[model samples]
Target: MSYLSQITSPTLLIDEKICRANIKRMSDKAARHDMKLVPHWKTAQSHIIGDWAKEYGIKEVTASSIKMAEYLCGQGWDNIHIAFPFNTLEIPKLNELAKTQSLSVQVINPVTAQKLVDGLTEKVGFFIEIDAGYGRTGVHVSDFGLIEEILLTAKKSDKLYFKGFYLHAGHSYYMPDIPALYEQTRDALGMLKAKYQSEYPELVTRTGDTPGCAVMEDFGDIDEMGPGNFVFFDLMQANLGGCEKSEIAVALAVPVVDINRDRGEILVHGGGVHLAKDVLVDENGNKNFGEIVYLNEYGWTIPDHEDRSYLKSISQEHGIVKASKSLLNSVQIGDLLGVLPVHSCMTADCMGAYLSLDGKWIDHAEGCH
Candidate 1:
């Protein structure tokens, strides 16, 4: 049977071949730059797909939360790092999970550091989170006093081991000049690593933004690259020039429900609930929920630029596709149309599981043990 015969609802379709290729590309990039590719599992949160990464020698993985770390540990990952700021309340859970695997957590404040020191039974490594310019979390790069305070607080307990610094530099996702953003981050991290490497001789630096990790060839002082979204490049990454549209490994297979030729639009059964609410504003100042692609026997292909169609608007369970004349004529009601998501990470989390092109059901983190 064809792959489409297994589809009944809006499903996330993963092209495993394309996904493996993207993995190999990133793995090769890490080898060339002499950095460890500790990919974040927040994107394709599937142990089945995670096996593909292991084929490329990625033994260590990054998780977005303690819960994610626990899930990864159950999958037999020996070394896992939780990239989110340390949540002291989850210390009991963290301690339990750390006993089975080499676990690391991100700490932005001394208070959390002390909590870890007081509560941690099993020794766990801590990365001082640095806010180079992202302003989301992490201590400011120039706040040497705060940095020292956090480090000193953590050092009070033998249970807490310092594991250098972590920076996400999230602005690279929207910033037009990635090289400039990366340079500023490199300098800030380089300075921090230089100042403290003598104290902690085994110190390492890690960067976690997909845009910077995907595009930049030169990783100055960064010892580890922890990007998640590059595994399934979304519409946002393609717009930001991180990857070509063809490299997007996952697409939403939404069944067409309506054809509105009068308004030159088509409607699908996919919306915020399945695609997430992440939207990208195009160069023409229009909001785009997802970009449309067509499915075939092998997988899917990006539509011709001259006849591009995209999900211009999305509600809770409905998607409105702004279609060109050629796009409008291409499909009918009840047909399955592929959509490249705005954010692959969020979309994958929302969809919960995947239907690979080879007709296998892949389990993801959502709703899994």
Candidate 2:
């Protein structure tokens, strides 16, 4: 039997070849621009994937939480940066990890900085998270006083040293096209560089957002890039023009459970519990749970008539695919159907682990086992 025959329920399938290709492309881009490519591990959340990244000469990486950092550290990652805001409650864990590894954490305000200073027993590096118009976290770009205060506190602490500024530029993901995305990235980075490069000439400026990093050609004066979602570009990334459809590396293989010829619908065992609740709205404002694809002995292929062959909606344990009558006729109740996720990060987190095409179970942070 084939791998598809073995998958009985919702299984996340990772194409190793496609994944390495995506990694190489981004690595080469960072090399050409002369910036550090400290990829965010929050996407793959796998030590095996981190080893693959090492093959391309990536020595440092970024994580979303202290637990993830500890996991990666145990896997022999010496230089790890926790990209999320500094949580004072995790100070003991942070100090313990810092004793063995070159650890860094992000600080958004003076209060957080002071807390780190008071709680940290081991020396740690601090990066001020700058709000590059994302409005999610970080101090605003114009808030120079708060930024300075955070920096000064870090400088005064023997256990903490100022690393630099970092931004996510998440708003770039909402742009209508690549040009708008690129422009927003440039403006954001330029604003930060212009404001602080003179005062802190040695501080590194780090930025990470899949949409901006994948689409933008010019990364004006950025010292580091930390994009994570580029590892497994999704339907949303492709739709947003960040990458080609062929570059998407992971897909959820679901077992077809029913077919409705009258309604042009196909039901699968996969749903929000497997793919997450993230939706991608099309140009016509049609909300999609994911993009459906046809599975065969060779592999999977995206449908030519995607508008009629894509995932329409999903619930806790069921996914409704609205496809053409001819397409719906081709699927059977026991067949394995593939779905490219709207957001690969959320989908991977939901699935907990991955099943590689070569017939191996790849362990992640939240493994199903």
Candidate 3:
């Protein structure tokens, strides 16, 4: 009887020790750079993991939605920043949270700022978003005047305190190499903070996205850092040069339900419902949905496997193996196949809870993002 033997099929397994190490690594990175380490709770939404981050001196946390801020507030940690552009519908909850604790919300436009001024009953910190090449939400980096105008308008109300600017170089996650990622981080932050000449020159220029914060050492003029995915570095991170394969802390343990030897495929019980549809295509257009590893008699084992040792392609619920015809024949119906997800964030969201490699159960405490 082994750790894998006791677990059920399609269970989300997290290597506890590795998960701890991953949190420390990101916290250490922020400490060394002399920036505030606002660990984003959007990645591993487990309260247990959040406590681990707090033990590592993570006083501030960032979240992707107002609901997450509520979830964290329920757990008694107050200093939080809802990193996404403010959702107008959540104003009532935002007002409620601000009364009890410190809350900073992101605003991408003047319309949102005006709304904040109108409905915000209590004072709140605001981080003006800058679209520094990601093209997601923020105001364009060239339009600093627009940011100044919004700040000025908010100033008249006295209900909002200007925290600083925030930009997420999310496009950097698509890079094919580390050098490209590092350059993207440096260039994006450099252009955004090129004119920080106010008396409070420390205007909290920040960027989130784990690839830039984890791989690059030259993110210029960043006052605060938010790197969430490094807590469970996925295959996409490794493939994109954020970290090595060894840094991946979580993997899905899917049981092989069938073996299609005629077509050279191994069908696993885990589907897109468990792993999500996050596939990564290489430069030559080779698509890899997930990485497969062998889990042996010991805990969730990797068996000293290399990158391409197991299967790769995935469907909504069925994972298609890339193994040789002979290897496919060796797989049994009840065999458990350890799968590394292409994107940990999506995969973990699909999985409601986790089964530790050591046969312990750790419930995912955070609510849906």
Whose lDDT is greatest here?
Answer: 1
Question: Between prediction 2 and prediction 3, which has the larger lDDT?
Answer: 2
lDDT of each: 0.90, 0.85, 0.78
Global fold similarity of model 3 (TM-score): 0.90
lDDT of 2 by residue, 1-369 (tens): 556766888999988888999999999999999988999999999989988988987888889999888878866765799999888889999989898899999999888888988888999988888785679998887788998888888776899987788888888777566566556556766776777778777778888898888988888778899999999999888887888878999999998899988888999899999999999877799889988877765567876654447788999999999877667767788888889999999999999889887667887787411
- Candidate 3 wrong stretches, greater than 4 Å: 176-202, 303-312, 324-330, 365-367
User: Cα deviation of 129 in candidate 1 (Å)?
Assistant: 0.7
- Span of 10 residues, lowest total lDDT, candidate 3: 298-307
Name the Cα RMSD for model 1: 1.4
Q: Scored by Cα lDDT, where does model 3 land?
A: 0.78
Q: On residues 7-38, what C-alpha lDDT tens digit does candidate 3 reach at each position?
A: 66788888878888988888888888888888
Q: Per-residue lDDT of 1-369 in model 1, one digit per residue for the tens?
A: 889888878999999988999999999999999999999888988799889999998888998888888778866676798998888989999889888889999999988998998999998998999998889898999999999998899878988899989999899976889999999889988999999999999999999899899889878968998999989988889888899999999999999999999999999999999999999886699998999999886789787898889999999999999998987877789999999998999999999999999899998987531
Off by over 4 Å in 1: 367-369
Model 1, residue 346: C-alpha shift (Å): 0.6
> Ranking by lDDT, best first?
1, 2, 3
Backbone N/Cα/C clashes per model: 0, 0, 2
